[model samples]
Target: MPRTNRNGADTKFRAFSDQTRLRILHLLRAGELCVNDLVEIINVPQPTASRHLAYLRRSELVITRKKGSWTYYALAPAANAFHKTLLECLGQCFDEVPEIQKDARRASKLKQQGGCCPR
Candidate 1:
């Protein structure tokens, strides 16, 4: 988990402390997405979704790419073996979580329907 000395493993764990952040990360497990995609799937306001994404970015748990006017985010490659394991655990850890499951299903449907995110 050696992203930088500024934040240690504790910060990474803290990134999971918020349910919104957890939901965002779990949804991102599938692939990169625009913020609006998350906002729609999670039923959160755009600002709220962006805030959580910013938190994850600061934690180095995710990375971003700019496509024209939109910003897309995805799980970053782990900085080390432990970090790799932690990222892998995200999907398994929340497997039975009702909220997480609902998010995933909605995300799938969004893709199937060609996504209304306009990204």
Candidate 2:
């Protein structure tokens, strides 16, 4: 199979197709988070959270960095107008989603408590 274009909508849409991936993306709209934070906020297993995050990384929708032994993730900055619009839409589309809203609340509280990893 041919490699999907990182900038192509097909790759991104495929990544976004999963409900877990969407929840992760929605939570990331706020700021950077650690894998542990995502596991806690999204209430998923660590491997499951890592799997979705890897998909997002392949889709080029999220970026990562390291601080000590922890990896942090954040929504990647838009690389084009299409990506810009998609990210904008992502923010607006999920406000009324109860599951994501609950994730957001938990994420907020986690942040206030200094998160699951050191900054």
In order, candidate lDDTs are 0.88, 0.91
Mind sharing the TM-score for model 1?
Answer: 0.91
Model 2: per-residue Cα lDDT at residue 31:
91
Name the lDDT value of residue 116 in candidate 2: 89
- Per-model TM against the reference: 0.91, 0.93
Model 2 compared with the native: what TM-score? 0.93
Residue pairs with backbone overlap in model 1: none
lDDT of 2 at 95: 84
Clash-forming residue pairs, model 2:
none
Highest TM-score among the candidates is held by which one? 2
Query: What is the per-residue lDDT of model 1 for residues 1-119, given as tens digits with 9 covering 90 to 100?
Result: 64555357878888889999999988888999899899889999999999999989998999999977889999989998878888888978897999998998999999998775555
Candidate 1 residue-wise lDDT at 22 = 92
RMSD of 2: 1.4
